[model samples]
Target: MHMSVANVVIIFSIFSSAEPYSGQPHIVFFVVDDLGWNDVGYHNSYIKTPTIDMLAKSGVRLNNYYVASHCVPSRNMLISGRHVIDIGLQHGEIGYYPRGLPLDEFTIADKLKEIGYATHLIGKWHCGCYSNHSLPHNRGFDTFFGYLGSSDDHYTHIIMSNGLADLRLNDECVGYKYFGDYSTIMYANEAKNIIAQHDENKPLFLMLAFSAVHKPIQVPDVYMQYYKSTIHDNERRTYAGMASCVDEAIANITEALENKGMLKNSVIVLTTDNGGGSVGNNWPLRGRKNSHWEGGVRGVAFVYSDLLPMDVRGTENSELMHITDWFPTLVKLGGGNPCERKNLYGVDQWEMIRGMEPSARGEVLIALDTTRKASEEYRTGPFKYDKFDITTFAAIKMGKWKLLTGDSTYRNFWDMPDPEYGVIDDEDFDDTRMVRLYDLVDDPSERTDVSEERQDIVHEMLAKLDGYEKAAVPPQMQTKPRLDNHVLECMGPWID
Candidate 1:
């Protein structure tokens, strides 16, 4: 006997409910843009961020948390519970396609909805800019009030609600607007209003994605003046002001939760989409936002829950975790089933947070320029293998031992054959044919190359890197770029 689609859904629901905790938790995910690892006061920042500091003190701090090197991909991973490359999302600037989040593939929001929760996404819906497929309303959000694109004027914001461009400032209907005073403050007020109006009977899943501490560095005069006194650098001063706005917003949100008596039953998470830009510092790690270095991927994260003890509330966890983990972790916390059928990349970190699990153990694969549109690097454990040139793959580890196939400058030993293809595009230009290895443990800054003394380890790591690349998804087979017509049909007109 053949089963109908509804039958299949019923069976899936039954299977999902077989677990002990099948109820959904009230989730508030506060994703910040370009916020540095050390930008918050809890992370040693000079700027005053009392709200975030309070949250950190009341919750757990993830010391080794990681995210995509950029925004869109990181957000995709958080929602989809997959590596950015797995879903054909590898870049930040490119908008989402129709096939971005397949309807068949369940999302965090979808799962929560299934278990009886009200979903709302407020701010920066950058998943896609197409028609029905691009907006949060189509994805699983019961309500969506935010901009379809990335950055825009704060006051005259180009906002979309439930797939319609209905928001306007004054009498003119403009896409962009000056969001009088500070945008963060405005977003905070909006969030507070939404929370206050939420039905208390059902659980709420609110995604508070903020476009603060990002570029175009605009801030309200009040915050700017306050930051100028504490921060010396011009750029940092603006960053501090933007961060302060986010803090105040958080304060408003927490207060709303407290007043509604949902604070004890809710799980509130505050984290950055990725590492900071050149304007911010990711200290102890090298490199910035776009690179595969630690500085580019590491981010600031704090989780608050009333269930934990006060003494352990302000604790720190150094276990390595990534953005993908949030999906499974949230699901588990909400008493939902962790995916058991497929081999998902994320780990259920809820146990770790509750002191039930010892540490997070899983190898994370990061794809750099998976489309071969640009250069990229790969890191596993303490090892870093990169291909900056078409024929040179350099491997670096704890010590200073380095390896290279070609000469120091260009033609040192140019007779070597190109290295075998890893998980990247062969057509894309890469200088990995010449193998260069470095001991980076002592020389963490990677100032010198010592490949000459480490031929044995170099050969081993080359083989390992080759193995990893072979296991990774190739560029051509990645997500195909959708046609404009198809995009329009899927998402609707740019502004409907």
Candidate 2:
């Protein structure tokens, strides 16, 4: 159920200092890159994700969770609790741009560290690593053992785009030692080591952002063999193996937590950075990554914690949630005042997750890409102007209505390669509508458009978009750096 913006004023009760575990639970947040909505066993897909499915069944499933359409934008929001437009990163992913997330904004790790939590980050740090100042080690993580780039070759730990080693231990490059080790296993081993060496007294905040199921589909032969008989297509089978490896990594990490006696008070979360990629499947959800559709922004996520009330455990939460909400939610769970700082787009969803009240959030700005330009002139419905020419790609959800303007990059109904789940596109499918509206409450798959019938809602949402646009900042511009000898060999910060 969706709440109106007017209903968002409901006040939240701060957890008392006298609460259990001193009200600061250990947080284990796992971010899986481009995990498909239907890839997990719980979603009834052919992919094997036993650990993820079991944990989800024993926890709270986030049915209406949303994130950005791509990597950098979602990571930016998740870290800062701020929208991408406000931070000038709404355009696209950061490549060799030599730009990072604005350092001025306090990260989730920074906030938790203020309250005595030991923050650790393992795996992908794609928010940017162009400069020493923007590295994860400087961004409030006490320890960072991971890659600094978007993706890498699973075994070699080398970014194929630039052919540079990407693994690091804190600020030092350590890729040479991990050669030939599959990233999923390597990162899991790192997580286990951290847990084993952790101080039991302090609350631990661990963010395991895996680079699995993203690109360069590579997995160990053992993992690949598990899916060989069931998954016929080679690419699909390899993708399944990668996902399965992630599941195994999670299982290993969970076992370590249990062994450390930290599982009892830990809040373990699983979320995708974005929707599935090409080889991945987000069946019946309307589009893939890099689009403004539900399949692109809606995440596959869940929260597993012993702190949740018994009755609410293993239930589905349909309340609206965005990637930004985690910043404040985790801070609150760590016994810190999430309201101490102001202007965060995220709300404290701890209460909502605990099954106490409805979601405090009423609206979600799915995406706003001012950089998106029309490839050709197009018009449809009552929009008389050159809507495509003037419009910026944007989508917003308020209550039951979701509005879209400008170009939606990829618009297709994608399914698994398996013949059973394949969808046949109808002849009437229109991909040219520059302006579209859907009642997401009634049409979660985004099958029909109601823009013509609901001009009043369209105008209201357009005004909202205008307000956001006026307040939005331009994307940061940075020159591409020359690949010197040192830069070509290592993927650490190139700038001081």
Candidate 3:
């Protein structure tokens, strides 16, 4: 179903004949933090996501979307149209060297702003650190109302970073703490206000990046009441409640858009920033967040728009899509030519969203989670070679064939305190440390290994991975990721 360069001319005729948006289409990116594969209602989980499910039903659902396994890198790719490896913006963004997004790189907001679109970012801005020019306001957002660092206490809005508040309105720090007001609802109201007060003269490009369901697993008592019986684990139950709050927020935003008569003429993108953290279930997929597994890197994504052809809506797309594609795709949607702007690694996926092509991408340099250990990966065609230096040495996937070289006893993650999944596939056994291979098409769970029989395929894929490793730029962080303590010191005491 992949389209060739020759079919470009046919696109105009199809959309031109239909009733497209009267003017440039408004876009609202509803992005969440650490949402799991099975977290949403669409995946048949306990989590009630009626809003997300309705959006998916009315849009083109992308089933095989992928993103970086961590936070900062994923945000960087979505904004910059380049992977961390290519840009040298690798892990340890909490307080690593070369913190925040690079100044030279143009964010999606920056491109949208050039075309006279009103740009706003209303939530977590984790791509940069304090005092850096990479903050949302400095990087082309017309207005910013959110936190400026990694995960902060939702209720108090206080971060471990010097105990200062993280909330802000534009460059000025606002009331980070709201003793009783739920952060999710407060954010939802802010987005609703943005839509209500929007100037219809110009198209809107809004990124509502919510910080729900990340850590501290905090949720309002009312929201938690719904999942008390369904989820027994206290942390998981609270996490589900947090996700529900996010769901309600999305519903509110969409209703606001509809109320303002922007729904039919708008394009709304819904997804998580990355794979789920601990209280999440990547069920049916292997591995968790912080590691390069199907569960960790593959994320939930969807595009809902009445502007899209009627036939394409309510359908599923299995084509590959990386988080970086959003930068160029949104640029094109906002009436800007990304090709004419700067050199970019992402291709314009505007055509793909319209169901004109299968996928514009064939490969991706996934990520290198460089905290205390290394979780590196690169995928070409159907083959994915994941290299985790501290864990199992390497994992390769070539269509039906998957090759594993070793195993790791240390499966500890940042969010989860205990090893809860138990010894997977007897992987704690001595045999897992040796070479192995599996037919992924038949056994997606990777329960079988046929390395002894497929020695040739294993060698070929390993050679390909070696080439990628040589060209990749190692992460700049010389030390482990530490808490950012000087954020408030760097950001002045200007509470709004």
The prediction achieving the highest TM-score against the true structure is: 2
Which of the two, 1 or 3, has more TM-score? 3
Which lDDT tens digits does candidate 1 get at residues 192-221?
887899887788999888878877577776
Q: Rate the local accuracy (lDDT) of all candidates.
A: 0.60, 0.81, 0.70
lDDT of 3: 0.70
Model 1, residue 291: C-alpha shift (Å): 1.1
By lDDT rank, best first, the candidates go 2, 3, 1
Per-residue lDDT over 156-243 for candidate 2, one digit per residue giving the tens place of the 0 to 100 score? 9998877888899987789999999888888888899999999877899999999898899988878889877788777778988898
Q: Which candidate is the best by lDDT?
A: 2
lDDT of 1: 0.60
Quote the lDDT for 496 in model 1. 34
Give the least accurate 10-residue stretch of model 3, judged by summed lDDT. Answer: 410-419
Residue 422 CA error for candidate 2 (Å)? Answer: 5.4
Compared with the true structure, model 1 gives a TM-score of 0.74
Candidate 3 structure, TM-score to reference: 0.83
